[model samples]
Target chain A: MSIRDLARHLDISIGTVSRALNGKSDVNPETRERVLAAAKKLGYVPNQSGRSLRQGTTNTIGFMIESTIETADNGGSFFMPVFEGVQSVFRRHHLDLVALLCGTDEDPSAYLNRVVGRRFVDGLIISATTRNDPRITFLLDRKIPFVALGRSATGGAYPWIDLDFEGVAATAVTRLVNFGHNRIAIGVPASDINLGYVFQDGYKHALAANGIPFDPALVLPAHSNEEGGYQVASAMLAQKHMPTAVILVNENMAIGLYRRFYEAGIHPGRDIAVIGFRESTQSRFLSPTLTCFRISLRDLGIKLAEALLSTMPAFRNNYPQERVELIWPMELVPGESDVLKRTA
Target chain B: MSIRDLARHLDISIGTVSRALNGKSDVNPETRERVLAAAKKLGYVPNQSGRSLRQGTTNTIGFMIESTIETADNGGSFFMPVFEGVQSVFRRHHLDLVALLCGTDEDPSAYLNRVVGRRFVDGLIISATTRNDPRITFLLDRKIPFVALGRSATGGAYPWIDLDFEGVAATAVTRLVNFGHNRIAIGVPASDINLGYVFQDGYKHALAANGIPFDPALVLPAHSNEEGGYQVASAMLAQKHMPTAVILVNENMAIGLYRRFYEAGIHPGRDIAVIGFRESTQSRFLSPTLTCFRISLRDLGIKLAEALLSTMPAFRNNYPQERVELIWPMELVPGESDVLKRTA
Candidate 1:
C-alpha cells in the first residue's frame, strides 16, 4: 500500500496524509497518529525510490572503498569494525549504509563518478583516502556531503578522521631513543598516501626532538603486509650500519618482519627492537606480542559516520561541529616486541 | 546529462537513443554510431535510479556481508579477492556491485528484507551462507534472481558455487592417516554453516574410507581465528587421548596455534603434526609454514558471478547453465605444519 491508497481509504487529501506521515507541524497530532496507525496496520513499507524522488534524499549514505593488492586485507582489517560503529550511528538516524567498491580493473574516479553522478546516496564515507584523492575533488565539485576515513593532503573544509600517525611515530621513536638506539629504521607504505607522509614527518620530528640526527637512509617504504616487513628487515640488515630498532607503520607487516628476524636468528626483544603502528588480533598473538598503538576501529567508524552526518543537513542537530573534524589518536599497548635496549 | 536530454538534443525519440546506447538490433548501425558519438561528446552518464524505475531493474547487485565478533576478520580474508572476481564479471555486463553489511543491531533476515523491499538492487550475491539460510527461501518466494557464494541446505534449485570442503578434508585426513596417525583431530566452525557440516562429513567419510573408526571426541569446534586456533590447541593437549595430528579449517588461526605450541614447548611438525585448511599470505609466512590447500579466490569469484548471471534473464545469453553449479577444489601446498609420524 502507498500513501495515496492510505489517503483515499481515510477519505483525506494526499497532501494531508503526506504531512501527517512526515510528522510536520501543519498536521493535527491526533490525525497524524491515526494516519500512522492505519499505515502500520496496512503493512505499507515506504518505497525508497518514490519518496527519494520527491524528497531529494535517499536516507542512505555511501562508503567508497578501493581495494589494491597491498591494503586489500579486505580494505585493511580496520574497516569492518569501523563500519560497525558507523552503522550503529546511522541506524539511530534511520539511515542506511552501503559500501561502493572500485573493481581492480575499473578507474577509481570513473567508478566513483558513476554512483555520485546518479545520486545513488545522500552522503558518503570515503575510506583510505590518498594524498591527492580525486574523489575529494569530485565530491566537492558536486557539493555532496562526505567524510574521509583517512587524512589527505587535498586542502578543503571537508570532514576527515585520521589516525594520529605523527603521535605514533614520535612515541615509537622517542621510546626507542630512550633505550639509547641511535640507528633506527622505519617501514612505511611506498605510496605517497598522507599517512606515510605524516608518519615520516613524525619520525623526523621525534628524532630532532630527542637530539638524534635525521637520516634518510633509515626510511623503508614497503607494502603493508608481511612480505614488506620481511623486505624491510632484509634491507635494514644489508645497511653498513644496521638499525638497532625499527618502527613499522602497519602492524600487519610485523609478521613478515618477525619471520625474517627469526630466519636471521635475531630475537626482537633482545637483539633488534621492533615497533608497529596498530595492534591487531593477529599482531597481538605474535611472538613477543607486537608493541603498538590500539585504536578502537569501531569508535573511529562511529566518528567517521558522525562526521559525514555533521556535514549533511539532515542530521546536524544530533552531532556537534567540532567533533566532526578530528585527528583520532591511538593509545599505546605495551608488548614485548619493542622492549629491548641497545647495549654497546 | 541523461538519455532524454541527449535524445532532445539530437531531435530523436528516447527509445531510439536507448536502443542505440544498448546496441539493440532494431537501430540502424550508422544511427547507433551517431547516437554513441553524440552521447560521448555530450558526456551523458545514464542515471541508474531513473532507468531502474522504468525498467523494473536497478542494474545493481548487492553482496551481503555479515560481521560477527568471532568470524569478523571482516568475514575473514577470503571475501575481497572473491568480490574482485565477482565485480570483474559484473562489470562486463555493465552491472554495479554494492556491499550490504548487516549491522550487529539488525536481524539478518529483516535487514535483507529491507534492502530487497526497497528495490535497491536487481539481484544479490549473498556470502557466508548458513546451513539453513532463510535468504534462499526468501529470494525464491520473491522470485528475485540471486546466487550464494557458498552452499546451503535450504534446498532449492538456485545457482551456487561452493568450495570442495569434502575434498580438502579427505585429502588432509588421508594424508595424515598415511603418516601413521589413527587419532586425528579436526577444527571446524562452531556455527551451523554448510561448510562446517560438509567439512565434518568429509572428515567422517575420509576416516571411514581409511578404515578408522569415527570418534566424536576427535571433532573440535572453535572460532575461526588465531585465538580459536590457540583454544583448539590447548584443548587438544589436555585430552586423555591427545590427537597425534590436528587439521585447522581456517588458516588465519595458524598464528595462534603456533604461539600456543611454542608456549607449551611443543613442536608442531615433530611433537604433534598440525595441518591448516587454506594457504593464505598470513599462513604461508608462519615459522615453519602451514601445510594447506590452495584455491584461486579470483577464479572462484568469477565463477560465482557467472553463475548468478546465468540465473538472471538479462544476462542468460552471456553465461551457460553448466558453469553455474560448481564444487571448486583446492590444490595441496606442502608446508612443515603437518609433517610428522607418531611414534606409537
Candidate 2:
C-alpha cells in the first residue's frame, strides 16, 4: 500500500528503504534490490500515496530552448537527447526538468531575466549562447545557479559545459586533408554564436597546420539548418576553384546538402566528400551516410546538470569539487560520405 | 528606451504601440509596421524593458512530455510544432509555456499530481495518452484546467484535441488497398495506449469493409521509434504471406524502416509499398519521399490552447463556446514511397 508497508514486509527500516528507492549510494546493492522487489510485490508506489508538497526546494530546473523556424523544420529535434541527459542527472535528486521557450522575436536577456527574477526554478541550463552573451552576466548578477551549454565570452568564473567544437573541426579537417583534399570548403553558421567562432578557429588552424592556405572565400556562412546547407550549395559549386571536399559546421545541414547533391546529380562520397560536425538521426539516414562527429548529448546534459549542481550550495555536497569549465570531446563516426580519396 | 518612448516618437497612442508590438489584432497593418520600424530604430525591447512580476496569474503553462528510450532515436521531435502553436496563442495572453518532462520510470499520474499540487502551472497540455489514463481523472478532480493532446476513454467530458488516428489508419489502409494490395501489415505501439486501439479499430474496419479478415499475426506491435521499426522489418520479412504493403503508426519509426529496407535490399516504394502516419522534415528527406498524412502541428497546438482556455474560469471569455472533444483531421500527402501500383 505504502512505502512503510513495503518496509515492514521486508523487515527493513524505512530510512534504508527510502535511500535504496531514491538511488542513494549509502544503501547496499543487495538490500536495494530486496527493497525494490518488496515494494513491487506490495504495489507500493513510493511517490504519491498521500504525498506532501516537496519541502524547501521547487525540485525543478529550467532548460531554455530557442523557438524559431528552423526548429520546426527538422521535426523540432536538436535538443531532445541533451534534455534526456539533463533529466537523468536531475531525477537522481528528484529534481524535475522543464523546458522554457525563448521566442525568435523576444530578447533573450529580458526573457531570461523574468524567469530568474520570479525564482520559478532552483537552477537553469541555457544553450545557443552568443559569443558575447549578456545572459551569463545577467544570471551572475542575480546570483542564480546556472550552466551554459556552450562557452561564452563573458569574463567571469562560472560553471559551463560546451562541446569541443574546435576539436571536431580540427579532426574533420585533418581527416579530409589526409585523404588528399587540398581545397576543403567549410560551412559555418551565419549566427554570431560562440560555437561558430570556435569551430572556424579549429578549421583554420587545421588548414594552416597542413601547410594549406586558408582562403576566406572557402568559408561559407550559412543558417544552421537544412535550408542553410541548401543555400550554400550553389555558391560552393560555382566557386572559381570548386572544393573537392566540404566540411559542414552543423550536422542538420547535411539534410539540405544531400538534397542539393541529389538535385545537381552529384554523388556525395565521390564527386565531393562531406563531413558533418555532428552525427544525428537524419545524418545517419543520409544516402551515403554522413561522416560526422559524435557527442553523447545525454552525457553532455548530465555534465551540464552536474556543473550547475556544483554551483548551487544545496547540491554542492553531492557534486563536491567544482567543475567551472568543461570542453566535452566528440569522436569521429566514419561513413561513406567522407571516404573519397582524391588523386589530384 | 521603452515602448512608451517609441510610441511618443511615432506620435501614436501607447495602446496602439503596445497592441502593434504584441501582435494584437486591434492595430492597423500599416500603423503596426510603422510602430515596428520605430521600435527597431529606437532600439526598444518592449516585453521586458521594465516588466515586473505579472499579477493575477503565474503566467506559465506546462506542456508535459514523456521522456523514454524510444524518444531519443527519433530526436524527441513530435511535440515541437505543437509547442510553437501553443506559444503563439499563449503569447497573446502574456502566458509563457514550459515543457515538463515525465521520467521514463516515473508514473505520469504521480508526476502530474506533484506538479499540480505544487501549483507550478496555470494549465497543462499532456500528450501520449493511454487508454484509461488516470492523470486525466486526477487533474479533473483537482479542478485544474488542462487539455489532453490525445484522446482517452476516461468516461468524462474533457477538453481534448487529439489527432484523428482512426481517420489516418482508415485512409492509409484504403490507399494501400486501392494500390491492389490484399496482404497488408500494420505496425502499432506495443504499449497499452489509446491510439493503438483506435488505430487498430480503423485498420480492422477498413479491412472488413474490403471483405478481408483481420489476422492477429498481421498486426505487428512494437516500440514507437526507429529501433522498433528496425525490429519489425525481419518479422515482416518472415511472415508467411509476406505482405505487399505495410502501414506504420508513427512517422518517427519510418527512419528505421527505411534503413532496414535498405540493408535488406528491399526498396521501400518499389519492392513493397510503405505508408507512414505523419509528414515531417525527416519524412520529406526520405530517399523516395514518404507518403503520409499532414496536419499543421502549430494549428493543432493553437486549438489545444484555446480549448484549455475555454475550460478555465480566468480565460473562459477568450474562448467562450467550450469545445469538450475534438478529433483534429490529417490530410494525405502523396509521396513516391507509396506509389507502387500493383500490376499483379
Candidate 3:
C-alpha cells in the first residue's frame, strides 16, 4: 500500500502522513497513530532515495575491498572477524554499512567514478592498501572521507588502524631465543602486500636486536598459505643445516608447518619451536595449542567503523595531526607448541 | 586534481576529459590519449555522485545481516565466504556491495523500512531467516527484490539457498548404523533458530529411514558451539548406557567433543566414532582427520547473490514463485575418526 492509501484511510493529507512517518514533530499524536496503523496494516515502507534527497545524508558508510585479489588470496576467513567488529559498532551507532567490492584490474579511477562521482556513500573504509595506490590518490583528490586498515610503509601519512606487527614478531623471536634456540628462521609471504613487509621487517629487526646477524638463507618467503608453509618448511628441513625454531607470519602457515614437522618425524615443542601470528578460535583445541600473536579481528572492525564515522577527509587534504594512526598492540600467547622455560 | 585542470593542460574540453576517463565514446582517439596522459600526470579523477545522478543505477547491491544476534552468537565468521562469493560476482558484473548490519532487538520492520523507504539499494541479500519474520513480509509487501541464504521451514515461499542438512545427516547416521553401531546419539543446538530445526529433522528422518525408532534419550540438544559440544558429550558419556557413535551438528562442537573424548581416555576413531559438519579451513588437517560434511561457504555467498539479483518487482508484488531452494550436497571424507567397519 502506498502513503496515499494510508492518508486516504486516515482522512489526512499525504503530507501529514509523510511527516508522521518521518518522525517530524508537526503531526498530531492521534492522527500519527492512525496513519502508522494504516501503513503497517498495508505494509507500506518508505523509500531511501526520497529521504536521501530530502535529508542530504543516508547515514550509511561504505566498505570497499579489492574483490578479485581478496578471494584469490583467500583473505575472507581471516578478515571476517574484522567485518563483524565493524558491524558491531555500526549497529550501536544506528549506521548502515554499504560494502563495495572493486577490482585492481579496473582503472583505479573507476572506484572513484562510481563511489564518489555518484555520491553513493557518505564515507569509505578501505582494506589492503598498497604503496602508491591510485585509489588513495583518487579519494584524496576528491576530498572524500575515508580510513585505511593498514598503514603505508612510506610514513605515518594516512589515517589507519593497524596491528603492531614489528612488536609482535620481536616478542615471538625473543621467546624462542630465551628457550635456547639460536638458529632461528622466519617465514613470510613474498608478495609486496603491506602486511607482508611489516612482518618481514619485524622479523629482521628482532634478529638484529638479539645480536644475531640476519641469515638470508633462513628467511623463507612463500604464498602465505598452508601449502606454501608446508613446502617452505619441508624444503628448509631437508637442508643440511636446519633452524631449531621458526616464526611463521600467520596461523594458516603455522598449521602447515606443524603438519610438515610431524611428517618429518620432528615433534613441535620438543625437537623444534614454533611461534606464529593471529590467534584463531580453534587454536586452543589443536592437538598442540599454537603459541602465537593475538589480535582482536573484531576490535579492528570496531576501530575501522569509528574511523569511517569520524568522516575524516582523505589524508593529503587533512592536517598531519588530524590523520590518526590507531595501532593495536599484539600480545603473545604462549602455548605447548613453544618450548619455553616455565616461570613458575 | 579536477578534470577541468587536466582538460586545460591537455588543450581539450572538460567533456573529452570526462568521457576519456569514463572510457565512453564521443571523444577522438588521440585526443583521448592526450586527455588520459594529462589526467594521469595531474592525478585527475571524476566525481561519482555527478555521474551516478545522471546514470540512475548505482551498479551496486546491498547485503544486510542481523548484526546484533549474529555477532553475539558466531562473531560473523560463518558469513565471510558468502560475502566473498557475492563479491566475486559483483566484481565480474562491475557491481558493488553495500553491507548493513541490523539488530534483532530493534523492530524487524525497521530493516525493510530503511532499505525500501530510502531506496538506498537496488537489491538485497539476507542471511539467517527466522520463522514468521516481519522483514520477509515487508520485503514481500513492498515488492522489493531480495534473496535469503537459508530456506524458511514453511516450504518454498521465498528465493533461498541452503545446505542439504537432512540428506547429510541421514547419510552420516546411516553410515554409523551400517558400522554395527546400535546405540547412536545426535547432538544439536537447543535454540529456536531455523538451523536447529533443520538439523533435528534430518537426524530424525535418518533414524526413521534405517528402521530404528527415534530415541529421545540419545538426542542431546545444547548450544551449537565448541563449549556446548564438550559439555553435552561429557554428560552423554557419564550416562549408564553410552552411545557408541555421536553425530554433531557443527564442526566446532565436534572439536570440543574430541577434546572431551581425549580427556576421558577414549580416542575418537578407536573408542567413539564421531561425525559432524566441517566449516573450518584447518579441519581436514586435524589429527586422524575428521569425518564431517563440507559445504563451500563461498559458493553459498555466490548463490545468495544470484537469488537477490534475479528478484523482480512482479515477484515482489504478486508473491511470484519466490521460493528457490538450492541444496548443497555433502560428501563424506574417510577419516580415522570414524574407523568402524560396515556390518550390512
Local accuracy of candidate 3 as per-residue lDDT tens digits, B1-344: 55677777777787777888888887788878877777766655454334444554556677776654333335344655566688766676666776665654455457657665555566778766665466776676666677876666543356877778788788888999899887888887775557767877888888888888888888898766667778778977887999999988777677678878787877788888888776455466565567887777777777676666656542233233445668777677667677854344
Go through the candidates in order and give each one's DockQ: 0.46, 0.19, 0.35
**Candidate 2 lDDT, A1-344, residue by residue in tens:** 45677788888998999999889999999999998888665445534202222333566789987776655554245577777788888888888899898776778888886676445677898888889999988778757788888898888778888889889888888898899889999898887878889988999999999999989998999887777788777778788888888888877778778778777888788788999877776556556788998878778888888888988887889886766688888889999898864445
For candidate 1, lDDT tens digit of each residue in A1-344?
66778898898899999888877999988899889999877645666776666787877788888766754663536677877888989998888888887886677778887887566689988876778888888878768888887888787778888889999999999998898888999999997677889899999999999989999999999998888989999999899988999999988788888888888988888799999888788777788788999988888888888888877777888788764568888899988888874455
**TM-score, first chain, each model:** 0.86, 0.82, 0.86
Q: Cα miss at A245, model 3 (Å)?
A: 1.2
Q: What is the TM-score of each candidate against the true structure?
A: 0.89, 0.82, 0.84
Specify the highest-TM-score model's number.
Answer: 1
Per candidate, native contacts kept equal: 0.51, 0.30, 0.35
TM-score of 3: 0.84
Q: Across residues B124-151, which tens digit of lDDT does each residue of candidate 2 receive?
A: 9988888899988877765678889888
Residue A208 CA error for candidate 1 (Å)?
A: 1.3
CAPRI quality of model 2: incorrect
Evaluated at residue B156, the lDDT of candidate 1 is: 81
Per-candidate clashes, comma-separated: 0, 0, 24
Clashing residue pairs found in predicted model 2: none
After the best TM-score superposition of candidate 1, give how far the Cα of residue B96 lies from its true spot, in angstroms: 1.6
